[model samples]
Target: MSRWSSETSKKFILVFVFLFLLYGCATAPVTGRKQLILVDPQTEIKLGLQAYEEILKKEKLCNDPTINALVQRVGMRIAKASGKNYDWEFKVIDKPESINAFCLPGGKVFVYTGILPVAQNEAGLATVLAHEIAHAIARHGAERMSIAMVAAFGEVLAAELLDLNNSRTRELFMAAYGLGATVGLILPYSRKQEYEADTIGLYLMAKAGYDPREAIKFWERMRQAASGRRKIPEFLSTHPADGKRIQALKNLLPQVLPIYEKAEHKYGLGEKIPEPHCR
Candidate 1:
């Protein structure tokens, strides 16, 4: 079957499922938004843990003791505040040119050294950590996998019902879910997921005693860094900076500031931020 023909059938099945929920869904934590997910959280976490281990084997870990300590410190603080019971581990990769960070399911975090300069200070790093951690806490990855699974299943059902060839349908399944064994699969979050991550991340950073304003500053620096470079690779593509993110943070500032203030009162917020030393 041609790609066009396969996609047409896939779209038709998707529309049918859209009008009727094929699977019972769950609501996102903190945001309380309904999500059409079919995958179990346990299975999702297992996939994440497996993928993270594979990634670590292919990537070199940073030898800088100071950087490693800082990542651990901030990561632990945010995890503690998130109040979600999960095993957490943090690692700093020695990639000096790749500006990226991600947190897999079950609280595993990987931060690239390339992002250190952009982060600038501990608070900046906290922002990135908090954001990625928020993704894991909210099970956004599982939700995405669930959506893909439903699409794939829909295709299979249609093929079986209509007595069509299943090979093309299988290909559509991979395309829809992006299941290639590429080195870096850049999974772009939905707009809703991005906003939820921002919101929960702000609260986490605040509870961890990091200034909420640093999150905005970190994003601004990230935007500047991206513009200074040539083009971003497809594997590293991020959401466009529409200024809405910053504006949203500003609106949420009032809610998070108090938490930051409370944490600071308990743990003195006058520690000097150290300068970054490249290895």
Candidate 2:
């Protein structure tokens, strides 16, 4: 009787997982990659808005007219090219030491001052902005969150079914599962997303009239900037190696160059970025 019950439980779990995956299946934009995103778009956007509001309240915003103008100019162009009807907003963060930029789900983009020098010119800035916008368009944040939720549920189910009565054994099992899932599933998916973003971003920048080749140069400069730092292995890190990213961008130039040429208003790198004097 107990064996029959166990078999029934196993079958039920399998059926539930199959249904869950089928219900949550979605395809990413541009790449057409299928995804398992259980989170709804409305909830994801609400979370993004809340996070954006909290971040803006905490971070010092750059008030320099020149910097603001540059960011808005580049960001809006990329946003327009994306064809996503997001409530786009762009702001420069006054963090001179943090070299980063990100876009929230609803198209809230924030660029740190430190990354501007690396961006150097308008096309380079467009590379950064377009990549971030691609992340939002692809719904990567919600996808990641859904992956985490599924992982957690799997862990709980495993614990219950395995009958891990010994505390130490249960701990070991959970730890192993966490490590395996992180190394095998989450990290690889993150790298894939980064590569996907690079692809979509290249298309976006070209469509928006920026030279797609500048992306390679920008990433090359980034590689130089990180020359002295200890490198994380590509397998372990969420982002791909800078060299790999540069190579990928180089490989993609052939496809995007035609798009750039056909763009209605070619900016050809536009204006050089000026140093911000935050008021």
Candidate 3:
């Protein structure tokens, strides 16, 4: 009788989880992939704003007018292409050693000065900015957090289902769950998000009148920059392999090139980004 009750409880929990997931289903833009995001947009935007404030407080903003203007100009164009009514803002961070850029929820974007050389020109900059903007538009951060929340809920459910009374058994089960969830689920979802962003970004840049093909060149330069560095294997890394990303971009060009050609005002490469003067 006890065994039957335990089995019944497990089945009930599974059904409840499935129903909950269905209630939280969302479709990603551009790619139209179904997502199970349990968080609301308002909450995500609020959290993003708080983090944005914290980051701005710690990072030095670039005072160079040219760099600031360039970032804003490119960022706004991409934001407009996204068609999301986010309160978009772009700023340049004065980090010469960090070749990184990111967009927080609600369209807050930051570009590090170090990446400008690799970006080379307006089109290359568009490639980078568009990709980051796509992440925000897709609410990837919120989705990731929701995934973590679900994983935590699963752990709690497992404990109840198994009736893990022994402390050692509970510890081992938690350890295994954490490893399995991270490697098998979370990491793969992260890489999928990266790929989805790349696909969406190509369309956005093309629509914004920047050449979509420039994305390939920019990534090639990135690959060259990291040529000698030790690379994390794709299965373990949060991002897809650079070579794979480049190939995926190549595959997508045929679809996005027409969007660029049809844009009312094509900038092609737009303007060359000047090298910053030594302070």
Candidate 4:
């Protein structure tokens, strides 16, 4: 068979698989956003649990009872509000220099000790935890994977059409595909996921009895902390800029405030999260 004909046949198969997957969609909880999801819930959960176990074995876990108790308290409250039926587990990772936190698909949450200082108190921590939980509940990673599959298939189709054989062709193909996905597809969705996580997280935190207003304060502190370092301009960055994020939170307050007001056991700005004794 001619190279052109052979490549065209394979390209047709990739297109079919791509469209088949796109047809399988799921709506995200809380936000009700229609997400293009191709992965099975059970598979995603198993992968999350596997990764959680692997990370636990590799990373230094904070054995401080006080911090663990606090993380469990905040994590459980938000998880309950999120209405996820998974076996939720929260752990404090002893990474004092890395200010980060995240939730895996099956409700495993990890908080870095570094972010604790920025969190300052229980309410601030609630903001961070809730946001991470929101991402998991929304299956943002799966949505991205779905998008990535489409992008990859498109790249394959392009490669087949070009039928280039030089080593430089490989380099150009990588550059074109990476830049295209970054600029045209993935980054925008990442920013959207952040905003959705923020919105849903605010509601969850408020419903869990932590004052939603504290989120704005936490983000203000985050902005100040980030200001000391150089940052990629907002347009080029995956996350919304500090000013924009805080404003978005402020704008959302009107919607979440009533939920906060009605919370039966409000812990507005809770107590300070004393310095990590484990570090």
- Give me the candidate number with maximum lDDT: 2
lDDT of 2 by residue, 1-279 (tens): 598777776865784476466547888888999987755676557656765776788789999999999999999999999998989999998987666777877888889898898889999999989988898888877676566555655344432422324443233322222222212433233778889989999999999999999988888777665567585322224444466777888999999999999998999898999998887
| Cα lDDT listed for each candidate | 0.70, 0.75, 0.73, 0.73
- Models 1 onward score TM values of 0.78, 0.79, 0.78, 0.79
In candidate 4 the C-alpha lDDT for residue 103 amounts to 82
lDDT of 2 at 264: 85
Q: What is the RMSD of candidate 1?
A: 6.2
Cα error, candidate 3, residue 261 (Å): 0.7
lDDT of each residue in 17-119, candidate 1, tens digit only? 6523543467776678887765456654665666577678888888678778888888898899999788899988887777778887778788888888877
Backbone clash count for every predicted candidate, in the order shown: 0, 0, 0, 0
- What's every prediction's RMSD, in angstroms? 6.2, 7.2, 7.2, 6.9
Q: Give lDDT tens digits, candidate 4, residues 76-99.
A: 989988888989999998987766
Taking the tens digit of each residue's C-alpha lDDT, what string does model 3 give over 150-249? 5655344432422324443333222222222212433234668889989999999999999998899988887665557475322224343477889999
Where is model 1 more than 4 Å wrong at Cα? Answer: 1-23, 156-185, 233-236, 264-279
Task: State candidate 3's TM-score.
Answer: 0.78
Question: Which ten residues in a row are the worst by lDDT in model 3?
Answer: 173-182
Cα displacement (Å) at residue 20, model 2: 3.7
